[model samples]
Target: MGANPRGCLRACSLAVRSCLRSFIDEAGVPPAFIVGLSGGADSLALALTVIDVASRAGIEVVTLTVDHGLRTGSAHEARRVADLAASLGARALVETVRVDGRGGPEASARDARLAALRFLALREGAPVLLGHTMDDQAETVLLRLARGSGPSSLRAIAPIRRDEDGVTWLRPLLGLRRADTAGACAQAALTPVEDPTNAIDGPWRAADGSALRRSAVRHSVIPALASALGVDPVPALARTAALCAADDDALSEWASGLLAVSCEASPAAGEGSLALVVSEVSGAPRAVRARALREVASRAGIRLLSGVHVDALDDLIVAWRGQGPIPLPGGRATRVGRGTQARILFEARSPEPTRDGG
Candidate 1:
């Protein structure tokens, strides 16, 4: 906290603007950015910070509050957030999204939100901004750990990145704790509504949060870790994620370079896929080989490539005896070849012809 609310707000604003300026300097300034407002303290603080910074920089920006229709009061919250943006002389709108029953309610809601934001960003030719703080990063890492995810799972909440839709996503508050956002909101005299789902009172989990699976991890698991550690563990967990992200980034770069030299666009019956040269992949280090295979899967829009899939691809190159297609997500797979002339192709399986019941 600061001596007063204004001082605290100013400090928070500085933290955010500094990060944004550095990101723009490195990644090249986009035409503008669209901030996602949820009426929560984090997002309210972000909306304020972004408007102030963009105003100073003379950048045209907009705010969007996605109403997922998952809860009763969501529309009201969106309206409030929009009004806040308007008060600051910024353009804001509420984008309603239909949550499809996929994965679960929580996952579905997330997908819907991302889809809405990405749609807006692409339509406006600008990047999307989020207000994910260090606490969110910690919760994600903990959830991934519980799920037995790999190093990639540990790379939680990237500070900034471009998604598959070619829309850039920025999270300027990841370096700040969740408390800082609340402080920022307080400083700016912004009383954002408390999201009941995020409230964790004592050891008893809120009944309302049951539908949001992440709340379990955020409320229970994270607090348990902090209690056992005898101090707050969020910053530590976030730092670990940062380190993992750096390693993942380096490996991805290496794999990208390898793909340029050792892979080719497969002429396989078109899903627009890639092929890895057997000789090249077989000779490369395991790390480079595994990452290259993942890059191949990602390019084919198969992001659910598991370690088993990667290992199966490895077997194709090192222990090939003409294995059948190793299954991947999105109806895609990797098929092995016999020799140095063979190209391990990442291809989508053709749909089986349907028989008429008549």
Candidate 2:
């Protein structure tokens, strides 16, 4: 295993082959040729492992590294990542992106990184591989809990997500720990760059609190749980996430059925509108109501709404009877009136003149 990267690759391949095969077999989607390389241990290991798999499966490989330019030496780091990818026999693409802290630095950087990866995938006409590991999942769950979020938050990050655009995001290393990846890099004699941001005291540090809790989840929680329960906590949590994902899929499908008729109307009319009699929508199952509101907001390109906002929309939907509009985030909503008709208005684009509009 130390001499041959194939050994570590084989281990990962066995663990993830079923997951990968299912996506391809059922969805008729092939393994994507694009791998995201951040020059970090996790992503480097992922690229090496992916190259090994591609060698066996006879697939082309393209590596993409995004330079966010947030710190000095970022460009050099991206170049190094590209070189490593090329050494591993992947066609490397280096993309330099500007990060505007519109949503704060970290969030903006993440959004930009994802957008870059998605752009690469679109241009290449393939799915994109992300290098999220088991530790990231645990961290996400803890962060969500800290924020007083719901059980759905416990489900945390996903292993795979297919968007409406047919581009698939795959996380093949979600089953591996960060330690395992670091060990693999050492064994492979790979010098993966360490991102300074991971160690800095910023929003991530503030959220995790003192770096001790963050390290505990990495070093303590899984081991303590294994000691007491006789099994790895991460694997167990991954399974729980899988079940939750399935449940979410079912709920989403049910919501789609409920929305089919109302959404089939002209996009302008029903794009963000739901037309059941006010009585019907109000009395619909709670899950159904939440799903419908989420779908509508989604169609209208509004994603800032939180769980509380969704709940409020549900309440409003059930209580409405007259023509006045039900308020929603991003200045969009459904106006319900007499009879069965409802108008979905993009308040941002509505021609109604403002006090200052001349």
Candidate 3:
């Protein structure tokens, strides 16, 4: 893994082939694969490689480019990706989505993009594929760490995600590097567009440098860490994510059982909302208690919870004295009891509930 570009590209090609084949072997054969392409090097390389391999397995491949329409050339970029995907023997499709302005453009765009991809998977009966690399995983872990996240947040972006519709989204390039993706694309004589958002610095960077957290981590934080530590920190961060993911899985499983016993088993606060016995929560271990609170809030549609939120909710249980209520974002709140009941009621925000979270 030297700085030799061509060698990296060759290694990346082999790695992508292995990961994709393994996914197909484990998940069984799919009628087709819907790859979420962005005209970026990582996705372009993945699309081309999967196209070649899936065709050999008698499986069809289709590429969907999400035109976010956030930037000036975004639609053109999608068109370019669709054209390249078509040239690579994969059917190409394009869709436009309106990104909400909340939670920053990146997060809002991501949620919108995933919604579109999930829709495609359900409607077309195929799993969606993403081209997230190890670098992306590293950045995610770093971001979560900064936010004082728990073990689950440190788990970072998962390699595979299965939605409610039973559609599985795959990230075959999770183990690969960003540099290698570009290298691989170069090797095959395919030109990939450089997404302005992915640019680390210079003119491409936003005037407000901190506007995009991912970009800042990718360009500033990562480079600073590498310079200070005298080594590449991305791989170590990614490895930490893998270890944390396993731990999160175990904790979540245990917490699920604890929640079942502790919860009132009734949606007393309305749909997508539930109540938990205060005594049961107080009697549980801090970790399990935190998890139970996490579970309840997650069910109540709070997706972007941090350790701060978890501790605050736990305080309502273990550290309770006379605190009336604890505040949860998205217009939700938690109170110790209502009327004669000694249980905590978790409520959803607004008329309809948001279906997000673990």
TM-score of each: 0.84, 0.77, 0.81
- Order of candidates by TM-score, top first? 1, 3, 2
Ranking of models by lDDT: 3, 1, 2
* CA lDDT, candidate 2, residue 84: 82
Better lDDT candidate (1, 3): 3
| Local distance difference test scores for all models | 0.78, 0.69, 0.79
lDDT of 3 at 96: 93
131-228 per-residue lDDT for model 1 (tens digits): 99889999889888878865677998888888768888888888888788998887677898777656544222324544355777777887888899
Q: What overall lDDT, based on C-alpha atoms, would model 1 receive against the true structure?
A: 0.78
Off by over 4 Å in 3: 1-10, 17-27, 70-74, 201-211, 266-275, 278-283, 297-309, 322-358
Q: Candidate 1 at 84: error in angstroms?
A: 1.8
Weakest 10 consecutive residues, lDDT, candidate 2?
Answer: 342-351
Which runs in model 2 stand beyond 4 Å of their true positions?
Answer: 1-8, 26-32, 151-154, 200-240, 260-274, 300-303, 317-324, 330-358
Cα deviation at 229, candidate 2, in Å, is 11
lDDT of 2: 0.69
| TM match of model 1 to true structure | 0.84
Query: Which predicted model would earn the best TM-score?
Result: 1
- Residue 104 in model 2: lDDT: 55
- Summarize candidate 2's per-residue lDDT along 74-153 as a digit string, tens digits: 89889988988898888988999988877556677789988988887888788788888877886777556668864455
